[model samples]
Target: MNARGYFWRTVQQQEVDYIEDADGIIKGYEIKWNPKLKLKAPKSFKEAYNTDVALINKDNFREFL
Candidate 1:
Protein backbone atom coordinates (compact mmCIF):
# COMPACT_ATOMS: atom_id res chain seq x y z
CA MET A 1 0.00 0.00 0.00
CA ASN A 2 1.02 3.59 -0.63
CA ALA A 3 0.43 6.44 1.83
CA ARG A 4 1.37 10.11 1.91
CA GLY A 5 0.97 12.59 4.69
CA TYR A 6 -0.90 15.80 4.07
CA PHE A 7 0.35 19.33 4.96
CA TRP A 8 3.60 19.05 2.98
CA ARG A 9 5.06 16.12 4.81
CA THR A 10 7.56 13.86 3.04
CA VAL A 11 6.63 10.48 1.55
CA GLN A 12 5.71 7.84 4.11
CA GLN A 13 8.24 5.21 5.08
CA GLN A 14 5.91 2.38 6.02
CA GLU A 15 3.76 0.00 4.01
CA VAL A 16 0.09 -0.66 4.75
CA ASP A 17 -2.41 -3.36 3.95
CA TYR A 18 -4.48 -0.76 2.10
CA ILE A 19 -3.99 2.38 0.08
CA GLU A 20 -5.91 5.49 -0.94
CA ASP A 21 -4.95 7.80 -3.74
CA ALA A 22 -4.58 11.57 -3.61
CA ASP A 23 -8.21 12.03 -4.51
CA GLY A 24 -9.02 9.75 -1.53
CA ILE A 25 -9.80 6.72 -3.65
CA ILE A 26 -8.85 3.40 -2.07
CA LYS A 27 -8.00 -0.03 -3.53
CA GLY A 28 -7.82 -3.42 -1.83
CA TYR A 29 -9.67 -6.47 -0.54
CA GLU A 30 -10.24 -8.58 2.59
CA ILE A 31 -11.08 -12.28 2.51
CA LYS A 32 -12.36 -14.51 5.28
CA TRP A 33 -12.61 -18.24 4.66
CA ASN A 34 -13.62 -19.73 7.97
CA PRO A 35 -17.35 -20.20 8.57
CA LYS A 36 -17.07 -18.36 11.87
CA LEU A 37 -14.67 -15.73 10.68
CA LYS A 38 -15.30 -12.11 11.55
CA LEU A 39 -13.67 -8.95 10.30
CA LYS A 40 -14.22 -5.23 10.33
CA ALA A 41 -12.93 -2.36 8.25
CA PRO A 42 -10.47 -0.17 10.10
CA LYS A 43 -11.45 3.26 11.43
CA SER A 44 -8.42 4.97 9.86
CA PHE A 45 -9.58 3.60 6.53
CA LYS A 46 -12.89 5.43 6.58
CA GLU A 47 -11.41 8.52 8.15
CA ALA A 48 -8.66 8.90 5.57
CA TYR A 49 -10.22 7.68 2.34
CA ASN A 50 -13.08 7.87 -0.07
CA THR A 51 -15.36 5.13 -1.41
CA ASP A 52 -16.88 2.47 0.79
CA VAL A 53 -14.58 -0.36 1.79
CA ALA A 54 -15.46 -3.86 0.60
CA LEU A 55 -15.55 -6.79 2.98
CA ILE A 56 -15.12 -10.29 1.53
CA ASN A 57 -15.70 -12.28 4.66
CA LYS A 58 -17.25 -15.68 5.27
CA ASP A 59 -20.77 -14.38 5.87
CA ASN A 60 -21.01 -13.00 2.37
CA PHE A 61 -17.94 -14.22 0.51
CA ARG A 62 -19.60 -15.69 -2.55
CA GLU A 63 -21.79 -12.70 -3.23
CA PHE A 64 -18.92 -10.29 -2.71
CA LEU A 65 -16.21 -12.16 -4.54
Candidate 2:
Protein backbone atom coordinates (compact mmCIF):
# COMPACT_ATOMS: atom_id res chain seq x y z
CA MET A 1 0.00 0.00 0.00
CA ASN A 2 1.25 3.47 -0.86
CA ALA A 3 -0.05 7.02 -0.76
CA ARG A 4 1.23 9.70 -3.14
CA GLY A 5 0.88 13.42 -3.21
CA TYR A 6 0.86 15.97 -5.99
CA PHE A 7 1.79 19.53 -5.27
CA TRP A 8 1.56 22.69 -7.30
CA ARG A 9 1.13 25.34 -4.62
CA THR A 10 -1.98 23.57 -3.35
CA VAL A 11 -1.54 19.87 -2.70
CA GLN A 12 -3.50 17.01 -4.19
CA GLN A 13 -3.36 13.38 -3.10
CA GLN A 14 -4.09 9.89 -4.40
CA GLU A 15 -4.03 6.51 -2.74
CA VAL A 16 -3.31 3.24 -4.40
CA ASP A 17 -4.63 0.12 -2.76
CA TYR A 18 -1.56 -1.82 -3.82
CA ILE A 19 1.72 -1.16 -5.55
CA GLU A 20 4.70 -3.20 -6.60
CA ASP A 21 8.10 -2.57 -8.04
CA ALA A 22 9.00 -5.47 -10.23
CA ASP A 23 12.40 -5.54 -11.86
CA GLY A 24 12.33 -1.71 -12.34
CA ILE A 25 8.74 -1.29 -13.35
CA ILE A 26 6.13 0.33 -11.15
CA LYS A 27 2.52 -0.86 -11.14
CA GLY A 28 -0.50 0.79 -9.60
CA TYR A 29 -3.84 -0.66 -8.60
CA GLU A 30 -7.21 0.37 -7.24
CA ILE A 31 -9.77 -1.83 -5.52
CA LYS A 32 -13.50 -1.36 -5.51
CA TRP A 33 -16.28 -3.31 -3.85
CA ASN A 34 -18.75 -2.73 -6.64
CA PRO A 35 -18.17 -4.71 -9.79
CA LYS A 36 -20.69 -2.75 -11.79
CA LEU A 37 -18.95 0.57 -11.43
CA LYS A 38 -16.51 1.29 -14.24
CA LEU A 39 -13.44 3.01 -12.87
CA LYS A 40 -9.99 4.14 -13.87
CA ALA A 41 -6.82 5.37 -12.22
CA PRO A 42 -6.65 9.01 -11.27
CA LYS A 43 -5.80 11.23 -14.23
CA SER A 44 -3.28 13.25 -12.28
CA PHE A 45 -1.39 10.18 -11.18
CA LYS A 46 -1.53 8.58 -14.59
CA GLU A 47 -0.34 11.70 -16.35
CA ALA A 48 2.46 12.25 -13.86
CA TYR A 49 3.70 8.71 -13.93
CA ASN A 50 3.19 6.54 -16.94
CA THR A 51 2.55 3.04 -15.60
CA ASP A 52 0.13 0.17 -15.66
CA VAL A 53 -3.15 0.59 -13.80
CA ALA A 54 -5.75 -2.00 -12.85
CA LEU A 55 -9.14 -2.22 -11.21
CA ILE A 56 -10.03 -5.03 -8.85
CA ASN A 57 -13.63 -5.76 -7.94
CA LYS A 58 -15.98 -8.59 -7.03
CA ASP A 59 -16.19 -9.97 -10.55
CA ASN A 60 -12.47 -10.12 -11.26
CA PHE A 61 -10.72 -9.92 -7.91
CA ARG A 62 -9.95 -13.61 -7.86
CA GLU A 63 -7.79 -13.29 -10.95
CA PHE A 64 -5.72 -10.61 -9.24
CA LEU A 65 -5.34 -12.24 -5.84
lDDT of each: 0.47, 0.66
Question: What does candidate 2 score on TM?
Answer: 0.66
Per-residue lDDT over 1-65 for candidate 2, one digit per residue giving the tens place of the 0 to 100 score: 45442222115555666666665567677879898877766676666658766888888989977
What tens digits encode model 1's per-residue C-alpha lDDT throughout 1-65?
55543321115432233433544545544455665645455555455544445556566867843
**With candidate 2 superimposed using the best TM-score fit, by how many Å does residue 47's alpha carbon deviate from the native?**
2.3
TM-scores for all predictions: 0.39, 0.66
Error of 1 at 17 (Å): 5.0
Q: What are the per-model C-alpha RMSD values against the true structure? A: 8.1, 5.7
The TM-score obtained by model 1 is 0.39
For model 1, the superposed segments whose C-alpha errors exceed 4 Å read 1-27, 57-65
lDDT of 2: 0.66
